[model samples]
Target: MIKTNRIRMKAKPAGNLSRDDFSVEAITIPAPASGEVLIAARYFSLDPYLTGFMRGWQGPDPRWAEGIVVGRFVAQVIESQDQRFAPGDWVQGEGGWQDTEVISADKLQKLEPIPGVPFSVYLSVLGSSGLTAWAGVNGVLKVEAGDTFTVSSAAGMVGGIAGQIAKKIGARVVGIAGGAEKCAHVVNTLGFDACVDHHSQDLQGDLATAAGAPITAHYENVGAKTLDPVLANIADRGRIALCGLIAHYQDMNPIALKEFRRLLISGVTLRGFRLPDFAADFEQASAELKAMVISGDITLQETLSHGLESAAGAFLNMLEGKGTGKHLLVLEEK
Candidate 1:
């Protein structure tokens, strides 16, 4: 019997999520059963969407109960009862906050590390974040040259990459983030043409000024809290790629789109999507991102928190908008 640590999400978050919402516990883990793989976690990603589960937001079937924390991770196969996965192979999968997980082979995706590219990219840029951004910008929005593309949460993993992809498309890209620092990163690091500080006293006016032109394609990550202003500035016949609604993750009140009329009058196309919605295209999309990353056409940014337990604090920092780029927990060094 092997004892390992895992964060147990025992309580439905009442208001804002806190450390009390999760309890770290050690429990015995069984060896890989038939068609299963024993994986030693290397990296755990902290994403905003995971909060919805704790707030009783159901996703797919086989729902993530309040009793266990479900998360995405990069890990190495410690043992395998399946022929496809061999010991020492790296993979990414959906699992919990535990250092090791006994996962079925089908749920995991094999990751092939590119020369000169860090493995962390597999978890961040090439994982869910990259996939989400790709699904929106490439698949849904179909961002193209001459388009004025704007993205909310522009400093986040998905947002940052989305803006960069738009830049690659030769589009005029503007971003929306909380503070001045993040806005700077959106423009300077992420290569966005302009970035709006949503925390400003006049967000609508400021964003309008920065955009310089009506937004033609928008990648939305922050839901209604930031949608209204973006809506006010959208071009007629524009398109919106809707992904995360971080602001509403903890609240259950019916979402009221104050700019619903703008969407209607402008003949805007708004599509809400999750990563799982584009499962069939994951391989080709990820390959495209990987090639871009290797050729320096795109850059990946990430922040690492040492140790598995650091996930809680890292998650807190992410939710409070303290960290730039992707927030990841380092479980194993080398």
Candidate 2:
């Protein structure tokens, strides 16, 4: 028998989420049954999409309703009833906000040890975020050398990876982020050719100046505010990989895109993508991302919160753009 502490959705948020919407509780978990594994979460991932779940968005499965806060976690197997996994193996899966979870073996992915890279990266760069970046830049956009690539929220986990991958492909990458510090980090640390602060007085002009050329490809993260500017500046026949719209996540009446007609007039291609859509390619992409990180071809940044107790607050902070890089809840040190 194992008692695990976890955060549950106590009430649905009317709009912007607050810590009051969540409640922490301890539950006694049963041992894993046949073909099952009991996992102890070591790290919890806080992402903007979880906010939609809190607002009563039904996930892929109808059973993933309110009261259960959905999230990705890096966990260790404490017990296994399946032959495929043994106790003490590290894995990654949708283990929700719980400290311990008993799930089917097929639902969890066994993680391989990577020298020098922290296990937390499995939840960020080498995990869903990295795969999303790769699919959007390499798969959807098909970015090539000499292309002008633009990414919104470029200092964030997915956007950061997208911009870096574009740079590696020899594209002239420009990042758009909030505030001067984040913009600086996007360029200096993430190695983007230029970063424009979206909060600037002349956002459209700034982005235009920084890009210096009509964007050949755009990787969108923060939509609404950032989308129109990029659309306005995109070259004819440009491609856009629409990944996220963090800017409108909290708003009840989200702003409509002003330059949507640009897509039709310029013959641009805009496609929306989710990570689960490219499940088959995850293993190959993860291997490539791991090699890139090891060889310093890519850099990852993270903002960590300690303990499960801090999960709700960390999530709220991430939505508010109060943290930099990938926001993670560290249950224990690696």
Candidate 3:
């Protein structure tokens, strides 16, 4: 028998989530059954979507309710009953908040070593975050060379990757971030043409100044306040890949777009996308992203918190925009 520590939702949040809403508890697991594997989780992915799950939002998977919070993780197979995996295989799966898990082998993807990239990349750039950005930039938006592309929350995991990918496609990339530090990183480190600090006194004017040309494509990560300025600057027939609405996640309310009419008059196309929509193409996208990382075509930043006990705090920190890059909960060393 093995004792595993896991974090579970003690109560649903009334408004902003606090660490008090979660509880870390230990549970015992017997040996795995046939075709099942016992995994020791090394890293847990902390994302904005999990915040919605805590607030009674029915996510894509209904299992993400008030019991054990659901999310992606990277783990090592310590014991296995299936031939596809062995005692020491690193894998990625839906292991949720547990430090140890007993799951069927079919649900896990065996992770191979990528030359020069860290194993944790599987939870970030090579995981769902990367796929979400790829689908939005390459699939939904279909950005082309010479296009002026803009991304909100450009310092975040999904938006950061989308902005870099757009730059690689020869588009003039403009980024919208919260503060001066984040904006500097987006412009200097991510190689965007310009970055607008949304917190600036004149948000609309700054966005317009940075984007001299009308934006041909907009990747929307933050809704509510952030959406209005981007909508005002979009070119006629421009496209938008609506990936996430982090702004409205805390308060369960519809984002009232001040410029909704502009979308119609400008003939702008707005399409909402989820990562699971491109499940069939994940393998191909992962390979391409791996190559991009190895060749320095892309870069990844992470804010890592240690142990299952710290998961709740890390999650809340991400929600409050307190971290750079991907927010992760590291359970153990690989």
Writing each residue's lDDT as its tens digit, candidate 1 over 1-334 gives: 5678988766777787887777788989888899999998888888887776656735442536546777788899989999999999989988878888899999988988788887788878888899999999988999999999889999999999999888998999999998988888888887899998888888889888988989899999988868999899999999999988887776778999888899889999999987888999998998889888998877888888888677778888888788788999889743
Show pairs that collide, candidate 3: none
Q: TM-score winner between 1 and 3, please give it.
A: 3
TM-score list, all predictions: 0.92, 0.93, 0.95
Error of 1 at 37 (Å): 2.8
Query: How many collisions per candidate?
Result: 0, 0, 0
What are the per-residue Cα lDDT tens digits for candidate 3 across 126-231? 9888889998998899989999999999999999999999999999999999899999999888889999998988888898899898888999999967779988
* Alpha-carbon runs more than 4 Å astray in model 1: 57-63
lDDT of 2 by residue, 1-334 (tens): 7788888777767767888888888888888899999988888888888777777746754535757776889999988999989999999888668878899999998988888888999988887888999999988899999999999988899999999988999999999998889988998899999999888887889989999999999999988789999998989999999999888878868578899899999999999988888888877888888888988878979999988788888988888888678999988733
After superposition, candidate 3 runs with Cα above 4 Å error: 57-66
lDDT (Cα atoms) of all candidates against the true structure: 0.86, 0.87, 0.88
Per-residue lDDT of 310 in model 3: 89
Lowest summed lDDT over 10 consecutive residues: which window, candidate 2?
57-66
Please tell me which model should have the higher TM-score, number 1 or number 2: 2
Best of the two (2, 3) by TM-score: 3
Q: Which stretches of model 2 miss by more than 4 angstroms?
A: 61-63
Q: Of the candidates numbered 1 and 2, which has the greater lDDT value?
A: 2
